[model samples]
Target: MRLALVLGEVAQGLRRNLSMVVSVVLVTFISLTFVGTAILLQFQINQMKGYWYERSQVAVYLCTSFDGGPCEEQAATQSQIDAVENELSGATLAPYIEQVEFETREQAYQNVLEQWEGTAIAELASPEILPESFRVKLVDPNQAEIVIDQISGMPGVFEVKDARAFLEPIFTMINTLSLSAVGIAALMLIAAALLISTTIRLSAFSRRREISIMRLVGASNRFIETPFILEGVFAALIGSALAGVALIALTEFFVGGYLAGEITTIGFVGTSDALVVAPMLLGLGAVLAALSAAVAIRRYLKA
Candidate 1:
């Protein structure tokens, strides 16, 4: 009997404030969409980091005549290149240094020309313009710095470069954007919560006379409160559901259809991730609804 009364009151309140209920749903949907996008962006960043880091390598360029040093006066003796390779092979810091390949100036130049087949610059430069270098492939890319630092200042070494160095700035920028999205989502959610609370307060105030009659007839505060609380809860649940649906659609159409193929490393929220987010959104909505109703009822119940 009590449950039925609660349900009936909830239905009545929803019918009376249908527009306000829709507003709550819209606000929650937008807020959660931003929050979900932030989550997926961070996930993509991690995925790309893991994928690229595994393939990262260190390149140690040997001095050539164009390097402008003693290295030019006398081409790096075979002994100097041998010594550097031996030092790398014996290093304890990166026991996983799988192999190092020494590319001569001619081979380096050929590779460059192959990559720039259609470029005008390729026609202007000769293979001799390229420097000889040691390309080190590691079992663990994180240890690249160790190898780079070890060989950088050595005699006949021109420069040390890590493939990952060029990508670090891009990842940092992505992280910043993800954080900014989360910040904006938080602010928007707060606004949504406040709007929900105000709507509940006004609805409860309009129904105060009905509540007074129930109270006068010896109805408990719980009896009077349940309907208002249920109204908020229903509104929140609808909002969460709307948000979840929007997120899935966005991921499928925008992320999967377009971005996924273009950027292999960028991943959207998968089905499993969507399932996980669904409950969180529902819980968030429920909590917001319950809190809003509780605050609104406090003043009425006291009066």
Candidate 2:
């Protein structure tokens, strides 16, 4: 009987302010979606960082050509290559070095051509301009700078480059965007909470006379509060459910289609992880709604 009455009152409140209820639903949906997107983007960024960083290596390009000139037979000698390899193998930091693989200019050019197949730009550059390089894989990517600095001044080495250097800017931009989304979501969520609170307060005020009569009839405070709490929870749950659906659809459409093959390094959160977070978002929304309603009702109950 108590549960039925609570449900009835909640339904009545929702019906009385249908527009406000809709506003609460839309606000919560948008806020939670933003929050979820931020989390998922962060997850994707971390995942890509881990994946790429693990495979990251410092490339030491041997000086075989100068000033856009072709490689001369006398440019980089086999002796210099062997000396570099021996020095790397004999270093005190040898244990941290995974393995050093040498790629000839021919191999590098072939790789470039293969990657740029069907592109007219590939034909513009001569393959002979490509320089032979030592691909130095390290056990720890963070130690790449140390290795690069050590190899940079070597006789035959012209440049030492780490893959992370090229990727840092892109990641920085993504992180900035994610943080911006979070900031916007926070502002919207606060507005949503305030709106929910005001609606609940109004609903409670409308029933003040009935509540006072109930109090005169010896009704407990819990009985009076349960309906309002339930109302908020129900509204939030609906909103969260809608948000989750939208999020999942957006992720699937964007990540699975547009981004899947475009960037080999970037990856999105999988469906399994998305499913795991859905319940948490829903619960979070419900909790937030209940808290907002409770706060609004506190003074009225006290009076």
Candidate 3:
């Protein structure tokens, strides 16, 4: 019987402030969507980092006849190449370098041809234009600078290029985008909180006379507050459910389908990420709603 009365009061409050409840729902939905996006983006960045960084290699380019960098008058000699190979396998550098491969000028030119296939650059490329090099895969990719400092001015080397350098800009851009999404989500959540507070205050004001009577009849504070709390909870749950749906759609259609197809080399986030984030968003909504209702009721509907 008590549950029935509380539920009835909750329903009446919702009906009275239907517009405000809908506003809370929409605001929470949009805010939680951004939150999910930010979290999934961070996951995506970590995934890419693990995938690419483990395989990152440092290319120590040997001098060529046409080289413009700090190269000798001629192409690198066989003795110099052998010396570089020896240093890579020697005890001094063994801890840093996991493996090293020597690519001849012809092999380097072929790689350029394959990579730049129909381009004008490929048409203009030649074996003599490319440098022979040692491709060193590091035990730890972050230690590329150590290898670079050792090899940069070595006899046969013209340049030591860390593959990670090319990827740093991409990672920086992704981080910036994730931060922007998080910032937007925070602002929207603040708006949702304020809207929730207003809705609860209005609902309590509308039921002031009934609350007064209940107070006079020795009704417990918990009994009077439960209905208002349920009103906020119901609205927040609806909003959170909508946000979950949006997250699932984003992961499925955008991340899984579109991005996966376009960037096949890297693994993209899937619907499982949405599933993981859904409960967190729902919990956030519930907590925010409960807190807002408690504050409003404590201030306006004091027993």
Candidate 2 vs candidate 3: the TM-score winner is 3
Q: Which ten residues in a row have the lowest lDDT in candidate 3?
A: 65-74
Pairs clashing within candidate 1: none
Per-residue alpha-carbon lDDT of candidate 3 for residues 71-170, written as tens digits (9 for 90 to 100): 7557888898888888888888899988899898899999999999999999999998888888999999999888888777888688889998999999
Compared with the true structure, all predictions reach lDDT values of: 0.81, 0.82, 0.90
Candidate 1 backbone clash number = 0
Off by over 4 Å in 3: none
Off by over 4 Å in 2: 67-74, 116-124, 261-266
Model 1 global lDDT (CA atoms, 0 to 1) = 0.81
Per-residue lDDT of model 1, residues 1-303, tens digit only = 878888988898889899998998888888888887787777778988987787777988877666675465445667888878777788464476877888987897788788788798778768666777888889888878788777877887878899999999999999999999999999988888888877777778888889889989999888888888888888888988887887777777777777777876545556566666767777887897788777777766786
Q: What is the lDDT of residue 190 in candidate 1?
A: 88
Q: Assess the local accuracy of residue 2 in candidate 2 as a C-alpha lDDT between 0 and 100.
A: 75
Better of 1 and 2 by TM-score: 2
CA lDDT, candidate 3, residue 189: 91
Which pairs in model 2 have colliding backbones? none
**Candidates sorted by TM-score, descending order?**
3, 2, 1
